[model samples]
Target chain A: MVVKTVEGSFAVAEAIRECEPDVVACYPITPSTHIAEDLNRMYADGEVKKYIAVEAEFSAISALIGASAAGGRAVSTTSSQGLLLMHEALFAASGMRLPMVLVVANRAVSAPLNIWGDQQDSISQRDSGWIQLYCETNQETVDSIPIAFKVSEETRLPAMVCMDGFYLTHSVEQIDVPEKKLVEKFLPKFNPEIKLDSENPLSLGVYAMPSDYQSFREDLELDLQKAKQSITRVQSEWNNLTGRNYGMIEQYMMKDAENVFVAMGSVCGNAKEAIDQLRANGEKAGLLRVRAFRPFPFGEVAGALNGKKNVAVFEKAVSLGGAPPLFGEVLCALNDLSRKPTVSSFIGGLGGKDVTVNNVAKIIVKIKDGEKRFEWV
Target chain B: MFEVRFHGRGGQGAVTAAELLAVAVAVEGKSSQSFPVFGVERRGAPVASFCRINDKQIRIHQQVYAPDFVVVLDEGLLDAVDVANGLKENGVIIVNSKCDASALNGKLKIKEGMKVFVIDATGIALKNLGKPIVNTAMLGAFAKASGLVGLESVKKAVNERFEGKMAEKNVKAVEECYNELKQ
Candidate 1:
């Protein structure tokens, strides 16, 4: 266990490299370019063997689909606009049941052409049938790699490790970069459910009749549902190996709390600080950080917030006409509960704007003052 | 958690300085993070970077509003920007200048209990590295002023980044500024 201060992107790249993948196909994007560059450097230094630098993100993910179908452990990385361009390929990868991992240096999608940290990019892909996990630090980014591969391979679902773009990718932080030998023990080689070989002549995701398409879609949804268990199981295995366990949600100061702030990604760190300050001042404030979004941990979220007097969800993206996507999900999670807290939503930190500790604490104060609100901070 | 922020022109190595400090802190067995902020950055434009050093994992991913220490790589930024805008109650500002600490403190008129440390880091860098890249030299002064990262670890981090004569010059620059600092 060699601990060192490294940038989040490089840490992620090293983690993926330690997995000893068969292929890494990716293109460079700001805040995310270092990930590909580092992986490419590993190849140049003879630390890796297979790498494919594609024309664009669309091709990057598409190449991964081909690589994964051919029985290779494949990986890729992208940010806001690149993720948007690869939208179609994203669904195809999952629908084809090609298990792979894609690291998302989460950034705000552009009209003004901004490149900074935000959750909108991955949040927009929540319905694409991919497993999503948000990371709070570079340490978590490194820790999630093996778990992502394990869960994806088990459920045949493409898993995404979403992290705040510049916030995590560009920031230098201390990470326990795992050894390749240990990671290999944690992650066995590719166990493809079906492999495509030239001599064997196989077909994948092709010639779907109406009935076949319906069942394929149903199985895809069912597999996504089943992936939740695999995610938990994989994390349990990782905890047994590394003694580090990050469950579906991380709750801070939630006991005996009257108000709670829920958030994801690196912003959860800010929410935790705010909750600590509120607790220090004798306020009953807490924080619930959702680590997983797809197969959106509804039960755990509802269980955590059932008896709270108020809950505030601070997200970085908007769902246009409706409430923020996370806020909407939180409401759904709480709807079936007998006890429900009035939840408010705030969209903040867009385009890399600062989401200060003071901002989160202020929202907690508002939630407790009998004010239910949803607005940009 | 102790927070620090750096202010300098785009061409200066303020961001690199912060990252190197984080690496040094990590070598000390503590958790640290560093990031830079810029918008349409140009040469000589004001750029800010932030670092947080903690005994445990730090969770807040926000800009340092009330930094325990603020490093000004260029003294010129003192007039152009509100360098002490959200400083902590007992924060210190380390400046790279040849002026006396008392004179710089009086000129800034910062908050009460806020200490100011001035060092001729630019002069040391010019003498050793033959140019005005004061980031390494100023880092040594930062070690003197903040006492968060050790001078030895700072030198090691610098050595890892540079090699041979370049590394030796930067290390000498750090030692000169660090030794000259009359804390």
Candidate 2:
């Protein structure tokens, strides 16, 4: 590993290059544009091959689906409206059980035509059958790329590595860029069970009658739920190689705490600082960051918040006239607990609004004061 | 930890200035982080970027609300922005202006123990780079005024960021500002 001072986008691009996918198709968009640009430069320099500059985000993923079905490891990067445009293709890619990787520099969906960072883009695709992983730091984002591919290929499911746009993508910091040898040791070549070669042409994503379709859906559900173990096992193998501990949910200062704040993405860093300040003042505060958003990590989340009386789920994506996406999931995770935590929901940092450490402290204070209603901080 | 905010127009290289500063600090074996204020970036519009330098790793991912130094790339921003708004007491302000310290100090509410450094960066850029890009020149003044980083590290960072002739010219601009600001 080489330590380099670079933008989060550069670090991610370097990792993707190290992974050495067979085909890369991308359409550039803000925050994610740098990754595509760097990879394109590498392609021009004869470093990586077969980079197809597609016409739109829809074509980008469609191209990946084609490449993966052709028995090749494929990758792409996009955000916001670009990801939204791929909504139809997203389901097709997963339903066909084609293993590929998508790096989503997560951004808010546009209605007012805003182009800033938020989780709305990927969060809205919760039912799309892609494994979603949210990262809090650039180092974690870089580390998770190879892990995503390993898990995706293992589970026969496509994975989305979601990093907060601009917050992590545009930010410049020091990160350890893993070498090619290390990546190769962790992730071997792609050897799919089936492909579309003329030597053995096979049908894929074929039409299913309503009678047979429900069984296919049930199979997908079972595989997704079982992917939690694949994620954990792959993370462990990566941890052994890199000496970094990662889990579905990371707990901070939660051993003895009554109030816990659960969040994901870049906001978790600020929440950790808030927890430190609150602890300095003699308050028992803690934080739990959800790293894997899909396959939901239900068991780990419940174990972390089992005895806590108050839980605040701070998320950037709202379901619109319903509980926020993460908030609803947190409720489901705690459903079997004998004494459930009074879980309050907060929706903020939409469109890259500054969710400062001060805001985090105020949210915890409100939870302490018995404010259980959903709030917009 | 030392936090610095850079205020400049969209085309003024404010964001690049912050990133280069972080790279320079990293060269000295220190941890630094930098980022621009996310929004619709347009030319000639008021913009700001932030940088933080510390001995340990930085965990906070929020904007810098209280900055130890503020650098203004355009003097016109003084009228449009309260550039020194959350600046810490005894802070520093560096600007790429033809006006002297007292002239610029008259516009800002300079606090006790606070210092301001003024350099004709636009003139220096024209003399060296043959253009009005003053970000690298302002970085030189920032180095001397704050005494937080060495001139050699700043020049090295500039050399790494630009190539051949452009790198040589930027290094010259930095040296001119550093020498001119010497007390």
Candidate 3:
């Protein structure tokens, strides 16, 4: 179907339909509410089956986990507090090696309570063991859902596809809705190696002493280590089908860049425009988009920034005592690299303060002006 | 290159106006960027949106300090924001109000070489869409004042944004706003 106007929520629904998930469990939250409503509508219309509107985000994930554990392809979505509410369950889903996909509408986590666009909500859960992909456009948001499912199920791990709230969520745009046949071809039916069944009767989540528990945790670490390669393989398959190639990191004009801004999610779109404008003016500035966050592609990032003289890492969330969370991760990634760029951290857009191209340009200028320190505005 | 700043309250479709303008410009094969800035995410809080359209890709992401066009969606915002602070010498100010352009201009103390255009967008929106939302209506006047985009493009964008009968109503509002500015 040709979709002329689509909100980020509906775009997600369209992708879910294409993926043909066996079960969809979601709770209603600001910005994400429409996604649930759209899926429910599709379910009611008989376009999609086995859609479950759950009571809470935790239950939503739990239900999907149960369904996925039973050898059914499952999906869920949440935002901000809802995502935080599902934190414990998120870990369980990953630990159990369940192949599920979650759609996260990135929203500001609150003490004062903000329901707007920001990355803190998802970034806060960086260590949840799920592969995280940040999207910059409505089209990317839609396309990522099935791709996420493909990657998640391929590795038998959960995945989170994140888009900014209200910015991509409520905002409408023209997006190409792929045909169901094409999606089916790209994402085949999900078949799991282990599942819940009466006949098989295998015990999961068994109590283990420290002796075995350490090895269990280590096994999970090994799987996470394997996910980096799995992501590359799955992305190749996706690219072969859709003709769009997205990696753990998407680099833009970074090959010859002197100054580069590292960003994730929708801000990279703005940052790309800033880089293009600066490049036109003889400023060798570019952007590196962090598409995959969890199995943090450290080597790829290090390689991308190897030749750059100055790098500015922009994070939407502050790390309280340490550098911005993303900055810390990037620095860790660059630890063993032969060439490391001078890294600076800048935090902005907390509670959705709008990081425009001008803000990024300012950072680039600061980097060029010999500012090696970190700042938050 | 032209930069426009829009001032309105949240939930008033201020960001939509900027986005629609950006899309329309992109449809014409030009480069444009639209983004919003605000603190209070809820409705009825002051919000500002910016748009830049140029022959080349736009890089500056800061809020427009010097705008070639100023679109004021609510008259109340005049008291709260410096709407005309950095308006270009030949810039035009479009206001969604019943007050005459000269009267509103005097109230704003618009600098010399600046032109002001005023329309009762709330009235038009109420008449056409049965809502007080004036973003689309103001966009129509924006097209007339700046001539950056065609009115047809605005209508198409509005039709694309809203669905069913609502899209028809918004398209009518776009036409009315366009004709109002023409007059």
Task: Output the number of the lDDT-best candidate.
Answer: 2
Assess each model's interface with DockQ, reporting 2 decimals per model: 0.74, 0.85, 0.23
- lDDT per residue (tens digit) for residues B46-94 in model 2: 9999999999999989888889999999999998898988999988888
DockQ of 3: 0.23
Candidate numbers, best TM-score first, in rank order: 2, 1, 3
Interface RMSD of each: 1.3, 0.8, 4.8
Clash pairs detected, candidate 1: A269-B59
Docking class of 3: acceptable
Give the per-residue lDDT digits (tens) of candidate 1, residues A1-377. 78878888888999998898888988898778889999999998988879898999999999999999999999999999999999999989999999999999999888888888888999999888899999987888889998999899888899999988888888888788888888888887887758999989989989788868889889999889778889898898888888889898889899899999999988888888887888889999988989998888899999999889999999999898987999999999999998889899889999999988888889899888767898899
Better of 1 and 2 by DockQ: 2
Candidate 3 Cα misplacement greater than 4 A, ranges: A1-5, A369-372, B1-68, B72-89, B120-140, B157-173
Sorted on lDDT, highest at the top, how do the candidates line up?
2, 1, 3
Position A282, candidate 1: lDDT: 95
Stretches > 4 Å off in candidate 1: B38-41, B101-109
Off by over 4 Å in 2: none
Candidate 1: true contacts recovered, fraction:
0.86
Comparison by DockQ, 1 against 3, better one: 1
- Candidate numbers, best DockQ first, in rank order: 2, 1, 3
Scored by TM-score, the top model is 2
Tell how far residue A69 is off in model 3, in angstroms: 1.2
What fraction of the genuine interface contacts, i.e. the true contacts, does candidate 3 reproduce? 0.14
